[model samples]
Target chain A: SQQGEEDPQALSIQEGENATMNCSYKTSINNLQWYRQNSGRGLVHLILIRSNEREKHSGRLRVTLDTSKKSSSLLITASRAADTASYFCATERERGTSYGKLTFGQGTILTVHP
Target chain B: DVKVTQSSRYLVKRTGEKVFLECVQDMDHENMFWYRQDPGLGLRLIYFSYDVKMKEKGDIPEGYSVSREKKERFSLILESASTNQTSMYLCASSPHTGGKNIQYFGAGTRLSVL
Candidate 1:
């Protein structure tokens, strides 16, 4: 079973609008990372936020982690058509025997319109 | 920039055929992973390696196996490819540092079993 799940399986918005995707996980994690995948391509690492960190930012991407809620959100500010992709949240479990293995969510497909 | 390269962008094979999907990372990352992506199911990890000659099974490892004879190369093998194994296969690599496991991914191989 997948450890994480993302809400609003699909999201569409105008180019300048901000896109927000949420992810909820089942267990305690050492860290959570977000990745973006363009159509039919490999995923790209966007940002990573550790369990101890509440929020992080990189360029126009903002990520927030709430351990109490076992959830995380990725926000793309001032989105562009180039940002259209599937966004996935992956969790690195704190107690898993498999080191460096990540459990990924179902992912939210984001479509940015021009 | 980190570059994780896969052997093929697309592949088509028959059921009961042995198949190999190769991945190489130029960054010399310590950890490498293999995952399959499907519609509505997200990405499922198949196998991973932390070092040369070391391998670990991930969540969905039943139909797949991996080899890491060299530090920079990881190969996913399907002993007998089944129709159910048709999906997008991705390879990723990451460095072991700072409690961070941000993975860099390859463009993926879209495999079809006929």
Candidate 2:
């Protein structure tokens, strides 16, 4: 319902398991980015996928964007305890008077059990 | 590597007091942003500056102001800190180049307004 809304507010999984989260936005966007935030720390940039692109891979992270559906998904493969953190999806709206504005979604909190 | 730094890790203030949160980046980024993070609310942009001495309000700019007098530093000011203002404040910077312009964030400042 929000501009950028992520599903599965919290996730708990065993180490080595894959974690997947979904994000949906309302309006058209130029690109979508994923960020990870450890507890009590700043957010770390993960990956970015442009609207025209459907999938992107970075290290153990894989992100997918579906512009026609206005949705995106982030998949963390072989999760570790160190990967336990909150993940957020941000949307960079298409160019206009308010271009370059990055709006974040309510993040998905991932907990990796050691 | 791009690095963004906040002046404080934790700050305690009383209601109605003026508070200043400082952020500096070593990356010489062209755009800087200040955001407040709250549980379930995600990161709400307070203000952003594209260039020195130029600022634009973000989605939630009320009760907060920003200053960008230099290329690497941006400051967020709360004229009258309120209990509702007790949240994690984050600062980020990005080069406004033609690329993805992924943002680098500082370790947030946690402000508790009593």
Candidate 3:
């Protein structure tokens, strides 16, 4: 079973716009990571935020985690056509024996029009 | 740079046949995982290995089994391939660093069961 669920199953935007996607998980996690997948390819690790941290940034990607609310959000500022892809949030559980194993969310499909 | 490679980019097999998906990583990571991605179901973990010759079952591991004979190689096996088993299989490796659990994925293998 998946631990997280992303909102806005699909999003469409124009170039130079901002794209934001949200993910919510049910269990406590040691860290939450975001991934990007191009069409017909594997997933690329974007960023990882630990439970002790709240927000992280990498290039144009900004991720905020709210442990109290058990949710996280990914923000892509000044999005481009190349940024169009599927975004997924994976949670690393805190209590399980599979410490490093990840449970991914349903993902959000973002399409950026040029 | 870390590189995870899959044995096949696309494969077609008849139903009831045995299937094998191979993954190799060059980063000497301690963790390797197998996941299957579908249209609406997102990515679900099939199995994971923390070390050589050690395996653990994931949420959906009924018909799937994993083999990790070496540190850098992990393989997922399907006992009886079915039409419903047709999906994109992704392999990932992650380093067991301190509080960092980011996974690097291979370019997925698209399997079609006829």
lDDT tens digits, residue span A1-114, model 3: 789999989999999999999999999988999999999999999999999999999999999999999999999999999998999999988875654888999999999999
Shift in Å, residue B34, candidate 3: 0.6
Q: Which runs of model 2 end up more than 4 angstroms from their true locations?
A: A97-99
* Candidate 1: clashing pairs of residues: none
**TM-score to native of every candidate shown:** 0.97, 0.97, 0.97
Report the C-alpha lDDT of model 1 over B21-63, residue by residue, as the tens digit. 9999999899999999999999999998998999988888998
User: What tens-digit string does per-residue lDDT give for candidate 2 at A1-114?
Assistant: 347999999999999999999999999988899999999999998999988899999999999998989999999999999999999999888877443668999999999999
**B22-84, model 2: which lDDT tens digit per residue?**
999998788899999999899999999988999998889999998888899999999999999
Model 3, range B1-114, lDDT digits (tens) per residue?
A: 999999999999999999999999999999999999999999999899999998988889988898999999999999999999999999999988756788999999999999
What CAPRI class is candidate 2?
medium
lDDT of each structure?
Answer: 0.93, 0.92, 0.94
How far off is residue B23 in model 1, in Å?
0.6
Candidate with top TM-score is: 3
State in Å the error of residue A12, model 3.
0.4
Task: Identify the superior model by TM-score, candidate 2 or candidate 3.
Answer: 3
